[model samples]
Target: MNDSEDGRVQQLCSHDEEHLITSGTRYSIKGFRFEPPYVLKRAAGHLCRGHVPVVLQLFFLTLSAVLLLAVLIKGQAGMADGETPFLVTVSSIANTQGQEQAKKEKVYKEMSQLKPQINHLCRPCRWDWTLFQGNCYYFSKFQQNWHDSVTACREVGAQLVVIKSDEEQSFLQQMSKEKGYAWMGLSDLKHENMWHWLDGSHLLFSFMKYWNKGEPNNAGEEDCAEFRDDGWNDAPCAVEKYWICKKSAMSCTKN
Candidate 1:
């Protein structure tokens, strides 16, 4: 070409190259080209400034939700595997304690019911009888003569109380004092000045001390022994008075 035209064409080409370099890359005859590193850096900065925070927030939120879900699932799994036996153990312990308490209460109730019966069996005495010193005694409410008193006692499978010890004598004497004079089983009817019990026991000299002061003088046909508050006294056999009867307590044995 001519020199001037070539120079114009070169100028145009240089202007186009400058425009392409100043602006972002564009499609050219040479094919596509990338932007400047600074331009790409600015765009990447814009993307980070606009969307990275949101993306990070979403990611953190998702991670938190997943962690919470995992914790819930683990808790549920633990409950499924272990809750039943734990509850059953607590319930079984409570039931066993309740049963034991019920059994104890039942036993206590049964013992309370049987206590009176056990006492009655041990004493082996009638409802109206008084038990003392392995024997049972009955104080008659009605008055009877010596002979009739014996009959009354025999009818109840008992006999007139025979005082054998000082303790028994004192007990009977106190009882007679409170209940008025009562007939005993001793008499001097068989021989003068010699007392004998109805049970065929001879009165020993030690028993003579039981006689009241200046008593047993056999005054005015007095032959039967009557118990007084202070001591024994001889009285008329026919005279009516309250009487005492006694018997051995029944023995109990276990089978």
Candidate 2:
């Protein structure tokens, strides 16, 4: 019970006053009951004869109780709101973006399950504008020299197609009605022997390579390329053949 004679409540006791914790959170003190919830209150009661201000004591104690209740109520409300679709964050502490995200994902999945609207789209490729499984598809029909084929693909607001996965490659190959040859988005003219798609994507991810015979020898005569039924082959780029095109995902939308 040692404090300044002037009477300023710095610490509360009494064993109990409302104490703020390390979390900047307020809690009701137990095991000790002092007139005020501050160490200074106990000091004044025991050490000082009277100079303590009763009004100040009541004000501080009541304020602490109110603040503690608010914190508890807010915490509980925040938890409840987190389970909802949208979260409104007052401060960083009550932020529940992760929970909200989960809720959105759950809702999205449930809605998707109901069934998709009937699709009316055109499929070209080596790209699948279709939504089958989790991948897309596209297939080319016109047989053009590798270069012309690429130009044709670009003309229709699409680019030469690149295979992102094995399933796509197999799908395109299957869709190739000619069973002869078709241009794909892959070449090494700019950098010999180092093949890459028109998008500058590397050939590291090719799953099923359909090179026709012992070719791509950079025969020098055939600079562009094509993916035949079950392999790859070198072909002239300027040749008048069918070509593949990849429309932008935004434009790929089925009308």
Candidate 3:
């Protein structure tokens, strides 16, 4: 070959080697060159594009989960701050109503207790005198002999307690128990072994059961009857003791 032609051929071969190295081309044993096909590159690009939707879907799903959790927390907080107070208010109202009902019941009970005293008579009882049934009773603070006790009651336009029925006897007995021992109007001074009331009525045989056991044997000339908690007792007329006086409660006339 000529020198100029050989130099041109070497330059062309050098340029081709440089291109193969830069483009990552391979050579086979038979001196044939291989290069990646354009289709394989296009397939890689398509694979990368297909993964984009999956990444976006994962991000959006995570965001939705966080938002849902935040909404649930906010709803729970609202219930605690708002609904709790509403429940407490309802409980307080129920408690207030219960207390008011209790107070009303107590007031009604007190009024019922006062009704009997108000409806007994038109006129009120005197000071220090308690009215029960249709009669007024006076419990004496001072002690005196049986006869003197009777006189004291008579001076006040009353009489020593004359128990006519079991009810009256029970009332006098209860009062006498509270006021200490007291004198009644029964006596056998006129006739031994025979009892009579201050109102000139003879004591009924049934009333004798009111006497204490083994009493009224005229022991040491005991002639007067005294009231006690358990029953009646016979004592000397001169014995000093508290007394009870009785009188009819005055009724006012309506014009």
Candidate 4:
């Protein structure tokens, strides 16, 4: 308890306190300051343990939202620029193809409708001509002499009708029933008493020589043959009478 002892003990205590405060200290450099290594380490440990994972999750979520927004904006801009989307373009092309196919089918159907129908059971003949079996006949409406009648038929690319059967004879007999007389293809003008067709062809069948009772008597120098409702008869070549013309079925096919 002397005064010197007391003062020395007090100075030692003060020095020890100052040394403790200054030891491991941080210093300010210009406008920046640094923490001691131990303090910085404690702060980093708190951030890693408590808040770093939450901050990372928030950053990722924000980035994902920004990316989605950008995609939506691009799609809208493409639509506004009049650019067709992939699905829309495909649909439009398909529609155009369908229309073209429909047009082609319609044209084909029209052509089919317009085409002529031909079959074995039925045949066509020219207008104003009658079809029977395999031949077509044109019954004239005006009267002409035998030679002039043959010329008239030849002018139309046909020949004077030749009666080949009793059926044809009956048909002709019925056709000129109203007029009562029609010049036939039979003629003896080339050689008297020898009957022949307009083209100088002889009659092939003996049964075809049907005559009315006692006719072809060569009366009045009758050289041409004409028919009435009953049967054939010889007459003058200059006597005018309605005639008949004939053509094959093949020649009338265009009808």
Candidate 5:
């Protein structure tokens, strides 16, 4: 509105709940002079005379809305720019780092589950076919004729317990637990005294080889092999002692 009209409204608005007389008619500002009936009349007059306070308020509100919208858009752009580095690091952890971390956790969980059983079976020598810690190991305590032992292990889901390395040999030596002789995968019955292991280690030092001297003594009848607590020996293949048998853990039917 022009300064005069704005001045009139401003004055009328003061000392709320007081009376105002403009056109020889009395009016009181209970809450505002801009109540509906009066507001409608004044609005119509202002439209005719181009003096509307509500219209001014509408313009100010529109300006404030535009400013608020601009501020919101700028703030969103700023946040997106700063978020790039954080997104990169989160990908590094989730895609690459998270995979490695998951694998490590799985290994640790398996090891924790297996530790006690492995310690029981493999601390000395690990048997490849039996469940020890979280895996499997094998140990046989019965004695059989050489051929019979081989067949027995196979029949129940095992083969000759193959020794892998010097480390393994030493371990088995320790686990032989009995001070007696234990048969291994070595034989020369076809060549009589000229022996070789299945894995092709020549019958080297029968020194610790537990031989009963007059043993394997080329006795054309000795097709069998035996050993003693003292050393290795030869006997008939028909004899049976506490021979070792092994199989997969699942195959262990012994109750």
Candidate 6:
């Protein structure tokens, strides 16, 4: 064969060694020759020698790295999913407790407005106190004898409720429905069947008397009058019942 053929310079190993340089062989500048290995020569018909093993090793390493990364990501995601419910539950509980506290504070604030002050006109009435017709009215939560009720009203700079008009009467009637029977300012204790108001006004007109049917019969020495949903009833002065208190709206300091 020619010394140079098919882009390969055939060269003899120094001092007559047996190996022959064939096509696709490389040589160093110092005259050392390199030839493709048998495996690469068979696989690719004379490509570079030892590159196949390196390429396969790199591919496997890259594949292994990708798999490891995917496993780590999946594990982290699963851990997060497992813990999310507890975190969400705690957050919801905190929000609910905060809301309940806020509602209670709001209710207390509203109730505080009912507290009585020294002297102010048109000021808002305390909790459970209602305003009507330039007057603030309080419906007692507890029962007391008529005389005690009158005393209680006086302590608050008020008087037992005195109805001057039909509207006032209806208001008391409705209020007393929920609060039970309430003592009014009316009594016939001084004179039998002759009703008078706490302000010492005579019950002059028959139209102003909203007596329940067959009331004022004066049974059992009944003298004090109380009102219910129906109307007024003459009860004993010693009988205990809820009472209403009325104060002038001008009693509170005006803003």
The segments of candidate 3 whose C-alpha lies over 4 angstroms from its true place after superposition are: 1-122
lDDT of 1 by residue, 1-255 (tens): 577855664564345334434455533222223233454334333333334444453354355446545655665666656456679899999999999999999999999999987776554788899888989999999898999999999999999988788888888889999999999999988998889998889988887899899998788999999998799899999999999999998777654
Q: Where does the lowest 10-residue lDDT sum fall in candidate 1?
A: 27-36
Collision count for each candidate, in order? 0, 28, 0, 0, 18, 7
Q: Over the stretch 129-152, how does candidate 4's per-residue lDDT look in tens digits?
A: 888877888889889899899999
Which ranges of candidate 5 are over 4 A from the true structure? 1-143, 162-174, 177-181, 199-201, 205-215, 218-220, 245-255
Model 1 lDDT vs. the true structure?
A: 0.77
- Error at 178, model 4, angstroms: 3.5
Better of 1 and 6 by TM-score: 1
Error of 4 at 100 (Å): 28
Candidate 5 lDDT over 53-166, as tens digits, reads 546644643554465456556656666565566897897778997789999999999999999876565222343343432223345565666787777767766655554445
- Could you tell me the TM-score of candidate 2? 0.42
Candidate 3, overall lDDT?
0.77
lDDT tens digits by residue: candidate 6, 1-255: 233531231121111112212355443323323453444334332222323443553454355446545655665666656556688899999999999999999999877785554334345576667999877899998999999999999999999988877887787898898879999888888888888889999886753468888887899999988986688888998989999999876554346
Instruction: Score each candidate by Cα lDDT.
Output: 0.77, 0.57, 0.77, 0.71, 0.51, 0.71
The residue-level lDDT of candidate 4 at 93 comes to: 96
User: Which candidate order results from sorting by TM-score in descending order?
Assistant: 1, 3, 6, 4, 2, 5
lDDT (C-alpha) at residue 117 in model 3: 74
RMSD (Cα, Å) of model 5:
17.9
Q: Work out candidate 2's RMSD over C-alphas.
A: 19.3
Weakest lDDT window of 10 consecutive positions for candidate 3: 27-36
Q: What is the lDDT of residue 241 in candidate 6?
A: 95
Candidate 3 backbone collisions, by pair:
none
The estimated TM-scores of all candidates read 0.53, 0.42, 0.52, 0.50, 0.34, 0.51
